[model samples]
Target chain A: MKAKHQRLVLALFALAGVAGAGVLAASALRDEAAYFRTPVEIRDGKASVGEPMRLGGMVAANSIRRQSDGLTINFVATDGKASVPVEFKGIVPDLFAEESGMVADGRLRGDGTFVADRILAKHDERYMPPQMGEMPKNMKAPATT
Target chain B: MHAYANPTRFLAIAKPLTPWLLGVGLLLLLVGGWAGLTQVPGDYKQGETARILYVHVPAAWLGMGGWTALAVAGLVQLVWRHPLSGIAARAIAVPGMLFTALCLATGSIWGRPTWGTWWEWDGRMTSMLVLLFLYAGFIALTNGDEGQRQGGALSRGAAIYAIVGAINIPIINRSVVWWNSLHQGPSITLRGSSIDGALLWPLGLTLLGFSLLFGAMVLMRMRRIIADNRVAARLRRLADDEGI
Candidate 1:
C-alpha cells in the first residue's frame, strides 16, 4: 500500500476504537447516572417511586430516630417547602446532623417514604448549613419550636 | 494552512502573539483572582470555597481543551499530512499534562472541605485522573525516555495514541452525570449557566486568561521545536558532507 493509504487505514482503526468506547460508555452511563431530587419534587409527585435516586436537603431538626437494631436511623429531610421521611440502614456519615444539608441514595418506598441504602452529608463551602432560625410559614410541622 | 505550514511563517505570526497572550493572560488571572477572592459574595451554599471554582473550572477546561487540540493536530498529521501538526501535537503535551494535574489537585482540595473526603473513586475524579495518565502516556510516547534515541515509529505511535485517547475527554466531562458520585452536576454549560451573573463574569475572565496562557505556551514550545529541528537538519547535512 502507498504511504497515504497506510496512514488512512491506521486512522480508520483509531476512529473505530473511539466509536466503540463511546457506545459502551453511553450504555454504562444510562444504568449508572442517578438523578437528584428534593422533597418538593417528591411532594409534587415528580419523583418516581421504586426507582433508585438521590434526594438532597436539610435533615429536619429533632427528626432523627435510631431503631433498636442500632444500625438503622430514621429522619425527615426538609427544604423549607416540603419534607420526606427517610429510613437509612447503615452508619450515617460523621457530618450527618439535624439542620445540616444531606443527600441520600435509595429507592422511594410505596408508602411515601425514602428507603436509603447510602447517606451522604451535604454542606456548603462555609463549614455550616443554612441556619434554621424560624421555620418557613408553609411548614406544617411544629418542629421549629 | 499554507501560510502556517512553513516554520518561518508560523514563527512570524507566533512571535508577536505569544507575548501579548502571555502578558494579558497573566494580568487577567491576577484581576480575576482578586475579584473572585475579595469582591464576590461568599456563596450562600458553598461560601468562600466557591472561589476555588474560579481557578479549578478554568484549569479543567484548558486541560480538556489541550487534549482536543492534540487530537485535532494528530488527525491533521495523519490524514492531511500537515507538516507542522506533529510539532504542534508534541508542543501541546507537557503544559496540557500540567493543567490536568492542577485541575485534579484543586478539585481534591475543594472536595475535602465540601464532600468531607480528600478523594473518592468517584466517576468524575477517577476519569480526570485517567486523563492525566493519558497525557503522561502521550508525552512519553512522543518524546520518549531521556538518553534513548527515539525513532519515527514513536512519533507515529504518539499521534495514534492521541487520537485514541480522545475517547477519555468526553468520559471525563460526562462522568458526574453518568455516575452516582459525590461530585456536583454541571453549573456552567452551553445551554445556560446556572451560576449568578456576579460569579459568572469573573469566572469567564479567568477562563479567557487561562486559555490565552495555554495558547502562548504551545506557541512558544512549537517555536523551540522548529528551531531544534533546523539545528538537527544542519548537523545531519554537515555529517553527510564530511562522510562521517
Candidate 2:
C-alpha cells in the first residue's frame, strides 16, 4: 500500500511536471512566436496582437526617428519584400544592429508604429573576416546604448 | 551477464570518479554561467530579457540531450543487463524533466516580447512538450510497481519508450518544416546560425556545463541507487534467514 502511494505521488508529480511544461510552452508560443514570421506573414494577417513577439528584418536605411521623450525611437524594419514600421521605447541597440538582420519586439499600434520592447542583431555570415583594421590601444566594441 | 552485475566491483570503479565528476561539473557550470550572464552582450533588441538565453537554450539542449542519453542508456540496460543501467535511466529522468521544463519556460519568457502571446501550439514546442510527457510517463511506469513482478522491469520499458520517443523527437522538431505552419523555423544553427556572439557564446558554454553536470549527477545518483539495492537485498536475505 505504501508503495502504491509512492506510485501515486510519482504520477502526480509527473502530471504536475507536464502541466508545468504545457504552461511554459503555451506562454512561449504566445510571447516569442511572432519573430518567426516573414514580411508576407505579418501582412497576410498572420501576426497576433495582445501578446509579445519577435520581429526581425533589416531596419530600412534612413527611416529611423527619435521621439520627443528621447527614449522612444521609431524605425522601419523590412525584409526588402515588405516593410513594417517599428517604434521602440528603450535604449537603442548596437548601431550595427540596424540595416542588418535586426530584430525588434513589441506591437503594431493603431497608428502603425510597432511599439518595440526589445531588439536583436544577427551575426555576419563570414566565418573569418579579415582582421584588417588596426586595433586601437584600448579598443572596445562601439556602444549605441 | 552477472559478471558486471556485481555491485562491489561497480562501486570500486565509481567511487573514485564521483568527486572528480562533481568538481568538473561545478567548475564548468559556474564559469559557464558567468560567461553567459556577464560576458555576453545584451541583445541589441531584447535588452536584459535576452539574458534568459543562457539558461533557456542550455536547458532546451539538455532536455533533448537527457532523453537521448536515456534512450541509449535504456538500450544498454535492456541488452547488456548492466545492473547499473536502470539506475542510470532513473537518474536521467529527473534532470531530463527539469531541463525540458526549463526549455519550455524560457521559451515562453522569450515569447512575451516577441510572439505577443504567452502560448501557442507550435510544432517544436508541442513535440518538446510530448518529450516531457514521455519522461513523466517513463518515471511513472518505473515507479509504479513494488514487487519484482508487476512493473519491476523499468529498463525494458524505458528503452522501448526512449527509442519510440527518440524517433518522435525529430518528427516533432521537423513537423513544422514538412508542413506549412505557424511555428518558427530553427532559430539557432540549423539555418547557418542566427544567434549573435552575444548570445551564442553563452549558450555554448552553458550547454557544455549542463552536459557535464548531467554526467556527474547521473553517475552519483546511479551509484547511490546501486548501493541501496545491495542494502535492500541484504536486508531481505537476513530477514528470510531469521524467519522474520
Candidate 3:
C-alpha cells in the first residue's frame, strides 16, 4: 500500500481505540465516584443513605465497642454538632482514637448506621491538637465570682 | 509552534535556558527539603511523617504533568508531523517514569506509619501504578534496538501509544475522589489549599523546583539525541561513499 494510505489507516485505528477506552472508563467511574459528607450532614438528611460515601468526623469519646469476635467493632463519629454510629469488621487503623479526626468509606444503612469497609485517620501538621480544654481569652466571660 | 521547529533556533533558546533552570531548581529543592525537615512543625496526628508531603506531592504532580506533556507533544507530531515533537516526547519518557516511581515509593513509605500498611490496592495507588507501567511500555517500544529500521515509523507508532496512554492521567488525578480510596482527597484546590499556610509555602516551592528540573532534563536529552542522530547520518553517508 502507498505510504499515505497506510498512515491514514493507522491513524483511524488509533482514534477508534482511544474512543472505545474512554467510553469504558467513563462508565466505570460513574459507579465509583463516592462523595464525602460529615455526620452533621447525615443528621440533617443532606446525605443519601445506601450509596457509597465517605463519613468524616472525630471518634466520639467513650463510644467504641468491640465484639467477642475481636474483628467486629462499633464506634460513634461526631463533629461536635452531631454523630453517626459506625460498624466495621476489620482492624481499625493504629491512630484511630476518641476525639481524633477520621474518615470511613462505606454505605449508610436505612437504620442510620454507617457500615464502613475501610477507615482512614486524619492528622494535622501540629505537635498537638489545639489544647481542647483551653478557652480563648476573647471567649471568656467577665468575672462573675 | 512551527516558528520554533527549526533545530538551530530551538537549540539557541534551550542551550542557555538549561543551565539556569537546573541551577535554580537545585537551589530551591534544597531549601524546600530543609524547610520540610526542620522548619515545619510535626503533625498533631502524624508527627514527622507529614513532612513527606513536601516531597510526595511534588513528585506526584510531575508524574501526571509529564504524561500531559508527552501527550501534547504526541498530538503535535501526529497532526503537523513536526520533527522536533517526537524528540520532545522521547526526552520526556525517562524522567517522567522516574518521577512516577518516586511518587509511589514515597507514598508507600508515608502510608506505612500513617495507615499501618505499606501498600493497599486502592483506586489512587492502583491507577498510578498503571501509569508507571504505561511509561515503561512506551520507553521500551520507542527506544528498543530495531537494527536499521528508520525512525519515522517507530516514532509514529510511539506517538500513538503516548496519546492513547494519556487516558490514564485523568484517572490517576480523580481516583481518590472517584472511588472509596485510602488516599486522602486533594489538599490543594484552585480557590485555596487545605494545608496550613506554613506547609503550603514549602510545597509550592518544591513543585516549582521539580517542574523546572523536569524541563531541564528534557532539553538536555533532546540535545543529546539530536547530536547522536547527526553522527549516525554522517557514518551512513561515509559507508555509501565507500561503495560497499
Candidate 4:
C-alpha cells in the first residue's frame, strides 16, 4: 500500500477500535446508564424497596390529588403497561401536571408506593404556537389542582 | 489541501474571505434573532420560554460540531502530516469551548422553567458537560506544548486526544435514546421536525447564522495564530544574528 493508503487504513482501524470500545462499555453499564426506570420496569422487579431510584413515566390523567396541607400531593405514574403510585411533598415544578411526562426521585415503599424526594417535569418533543388552538386533546383539560 | 498548507496562500484566501463571512453572518444573525424573539409566537406548552431554542440549539450544534472538526483535523495532521492542521485545531478549541459553555448555560436556564432544575446527571446533560471538559483539556495541552523547542510530541499527543475525544460525540447524540434522560429526544430528525413550520423557520435561520459565524471565527483565529508564529520566528532569527 502507498503511504497515504497506509495512513488511511491506520486511521480507520483506530476509529473502529474506539467505536467498538464504546459499544462494549455502554452495554456493560446498561443498567446504570438509564437516568430513570418506567413503571413497567418497577413492576417487573427492576427497582427494589427502600433503594433510592428514579421512576419516570407520564402522570396518569386525573390522577393528581392534593392533600389538605397543600404541600403534599399523590399521583400515579404510568407507562400504559403498568402504573406506580407516587407521593411527593414540596412545591412541584411548573409544567408538572396530568398527561405530561414526569420523573420522580425517591424510594419504593414495601407496599409499592414511591415516596419522592424530588420531582422533575419532562417536556415532550413537540412544539407549536398556542394560537393554533390545536394543543393535544388531553392537555386542553386543565389540571384539577 | 497541500497548497493551502503554505501559510501565505492560506492567508491570501482567509484575509479577504473573513470580512464577507463576518458581514453576511452578522446580517443573518440579526434577522434571525429578530424573527425568533419577536416574530414567532410562544409555544403552546412552554410559552415564551421556548424562544431560547434559537440560541440554545445552535450553540449545542456547534459544540458537538466543533469536536467533529477537531477530530477530522487531527486525523489529517496524523496521517498526512498537514502543517496547518495543528493550527486549525488550536484555533477551534477556544470558540468551541465557549459555545459548549453557552449551550450548557442556556440549557440550564431553559431547564429551570421546563425541567424545574438547573442541572441533572442524566446521560445527555452529563455527556455534554464531559465535552466541555474535553475542550478545556485540549486547549491546556496545546498551550502547554507551545514553549517546547521540539513541538511535534505534545502537538501529536493533543491530536490523538482529539481523535479519542470524538468517541464522546456519538455517545452524546444517542444518550437520550440509549438511556432515559430528563432531556427530550431529538426534535429534528432526518425524516422531519416535530416543531410546527412557523416555529421551525426562525430556528433554521439562527442555525445557519450561528454556523456561518463559527466558521468565520475559526478562520480569523487561524490567521492570528499564523501571524504570531511569523513574529516569533522573526524575533528568533534576529536574536541569532546578535549571538544572544
Name the lDDT value of residue A16 in candidate 4.
92
Q: How do the residues B1-244 of candidate 1 rate in per-residue lDDT, one tens digit apiece?
A: 6567877888889999999999999999999988888987766555677789899999999899999999988887777777788888888999999999999999888876666667766677888998899998887777744211211122566777888888888887887666645677677666566565656678888999999899999999888877777776788889999999
Model 3, C-alpha of A4: deviation from truth (Å):
11
DockQ of each: 0.18, 0.05, 0.17, 0.47
* TM-score, ranked from best to worst: 4, 3, 1, 2
Residues A1-145 of candidate 2: C-alpha lDDT, one tens digit per residue: 5754664465446545655665566455553443345555677766766456656677777787888999888778887788888877776534334565665657666654567776654433211111311235266433211
Candidate 2 lDDT, tens digit per residue, B2-31?
665666776787788777777776777788
- Tens digits of per-residue lDDT, candidate 4, B17-80, equal 9988888888898999999999989998899999999999999999999999999988988888
Predicted complex 1: CAPRI docking category: incorrect
lDDT score for candidate 3 against the true structure: 0.78
| Residue A129's lDDT in candidate 1 | 19
Question: What's the TM-score of every candidate structure?
Answer: 0.75, 0.62, 0.76, 0.94
Best by TM-score: 4
Q: DockQ winner between 3 and 4, please give it.
A: 4
Instruction: Estimate, for each residue in B133-156, the C-alpha lDDT of model 3 and write its tens digit.
Output: 999998888884441123322366
Quick one: ranking by DockQ, best first? 4, 1, 3, 2
Per-residue alpha-carbon lDDT of candidate 1 for residues A96-123, written as tens digits (9 for 90 to 100)? 7898878887989999999998787765
- Writing each residue's lDDT as its tens digit, candidate 3 over A71-121 gives 998999988999899998997777888877777889999999999998877
Worst 10 residues of 1 chain A by lDDT: A124-133
